[model samples]
Structures are given as structure tokens and as C-alpha cells.
Target: MLFLPAFLTLLGSVSAVDIWLNFQTTNCRGSGSVLCPGLEPNTCCSVPGRTGNPYTSVTVMHIPSVWNLDCRGHAGNYCGPIRELQTSNGRNTVCLGRGPFGGGGYGFWNGRVAATAESAAEGNCTRPSIVSLGDGTQYDVADLNDDDFNEMILLLTSSFHSFDIVEADGISDDVPEKFNINKLDEASLLPRYY
Candidate 1:
């Protein structure tokens, strides 16, 4: 029985990464943020039910050399189709709400996300190739498995107006940064939906 405890401790020490999702852009400090600490490789790490999909930014830490991160914002309970945010190296404070599907236009994924870290050495996951349509749209195509058929396809629309990319280091949950006044002003100028 004692071996079980030791084994659990050993498993905990083998965790490959840590991920943070925030409701606000540019920072990882907010009431709607969540931290998925000590994530194991090759497994899906989802947002808790209470938090839902209010995430607009993300931060990843301690990425392993053999692992790749895949995060997506879904419009429903299932982790369905959407543009993915993949990174092999650790990232700090990447905004997710500045794109056409995010806050810039449709706001489809402003508050929805599901993430995972998979082992690249396992040969089960392959990065998708993004192709531009040259008509303000693009699509991602990938055959994740070794199968001949393409397994994933995501179409992305582009927005004419661009937003600044927000980056930060070492975010804390205790104190959140003040909301950007310029962004607020820009939001005020946008047409509101009924």
C-alpha cells in the first residue's frame, strides 16, 4: 500500500507543463481566469464547468522538449472546430480576442477554449498546414493520424482592423491590471448588436 503513495508522488513530479487562461486580454490575472497546473503529457486538459469558456488569453509554462501544445476555443461543450493556438515552446500572455472569430468581429471564441499537450515523439500528432485563400480567408489542413484522409479542417476569416498584440511576463492572480482605456474606446466605437 505504501508503494501507491510513492507512485502517485512520482507521477506528480512527471507533469510536463502548466497552462493559464484568462478572461481579459494581455494578462492572466482576472476573476475569470484558470490555471491548469502540473498537466501530464498526451492528455486533454479542459476548463472546469464553473469557469466555462470566458478565456480570452493564455500563458503556458515549462513546456517539454518532446511535447506540443494545442489549444482551441469551442462554441459548445464538445471541443469542436475552431482555429487552434499551437506552441512548442513556453509562451507568456498571448491574446486570443483580436481575430475575426474572436472579439474583433463575431466574438465566437472570446470565452471558449480547450487545451492539451501531446508527445510529439509518439508520432500520433502532426502540425496542420495553413493555406491562404487571398480573399480575406484561410484554412488549416492536417492529417493528424497516419491515415490518408485529412482529419481536421478549419476555415478562418480575416478582419481588416488590426489590434495590438499583448505580451507580459510573470502574471499574478492577486492583482489584475487595469483595463486598457484605448481598447475600451475602440469597443465603444463598434456597432452594438441588439
Candidate 2:
């Protein structure tokens, strides 16, 4: 949600204090690199304050799989352990390393992967493929919107990389509509991942 502060003045010139309220934020880790650390990955992360502001505006976070306990058949699901990233400017170059030269040593999301499907020969399909939690497939966290909330975009990267958006409510109750990537809009009423 976007918080637009209202101004209360007598003559449109006298203002005492400007209050910034209800800015969406995530408290993810930082990697202190020249790259856009965890700006737009399959998860959410916290971006530290830059040279201009005293508070940060961005963060990183992850969504547990709705299909399984661990991430299976999902590559690039891990958010942390990110080595380097690249972006473009007018004509200059920026690079973030592992040193203290303005490079943050923050960490990103690092999660465990799900176990492989059991072999039929070994025994029965004791571990059921489909569980109560929406068929035990496994989903990764991603940001569908850039508005910046802790909302989770469930990702299923298998033969094809498909995604769904779900507002996790802690326990397995009231699982909302699955997040669809094609339906994402910059100004849509849906929450932003920025």
C-alpha cells in the first residue's frame, strides 16, 4: 500500500512536520556489493540506506514451498550465496566485491532442497507425492510486484518455470489464489515486492 502524507497548513506555506507513514518494507539481508544485491530475485531482501537517506527502502525475503517442505526440482530458488550481479548506467560501471569498500557482507536466502522421489523398487510410495499442503510440489518465493511488501510469489521451476502468488498466513489455512506471472502489472492493486 502507498502512503501519501496529507499536509495541514493555514496558507499553503506553513508546515511543521512531514510524516511518512506506512511504507512497505522487507528486512532481508544484504551482500554489500556493487550489484543490485537482492533487488529483483526469486525472493525478498532488505536494501540498506544509501548516500541520500537515513533509512533503507528495500529488502529480501523468501517463501517456503507450498508443495513440499524443501525446494525440489527448483534451481535458482536459493536467494543467498549470490556471488556477483551486473547492471547498466549512462556510461559508468559499478561492481560490488567481498571487501569493506562500500561492499556489504550481507547474506541472502539459503534454503534446503527437497528429497528426490523415492524409487518404486526400493519400497512403496511411502512418502506420498501429494500432501495436505497443496499437493506437496514445492514453491519458491518471488516478488510479483515492486511495491515492496513481504508477499510471496510461489515459483515452480520444473520442466517449465511457472509461478503463483500467495499471501502466506503462517499456518496452512486460507490458501489464496495461486500466483500467476502473466497477470502481474506495475500498478495492479496486488502488493509489490519492492
lDDT per residue, candidate 1, 5-65, as tens digits?
A: 4654465357534443433344333212233445443323332122233345444445444
Question: In model 2, what lDDT does residue 162 have?
Answer: 29
Give the winner by lDDT: 1
- List model 2 lDDT by residue over 1-194, tens digit each: 12211221121123111101001121211211011221212221222221211111111112212211111111111222223332212211122222111111121122311111111111211110111122222222233333221222111111111222111211223334553322223321111212
CA displacement after TM-score superposition, residue 172 of candidate 1 (Å): 12
Return the TM-score for each candidate structure: 0.34, 0.16
User: For model 1, what is the error of residue 141's alpha carbon versus the real structure, in angstroms, after optimal superposition?
Assistant: 38
- Over 4 Å off in model 2, which ranges? 1-77, 90-156, 161-194
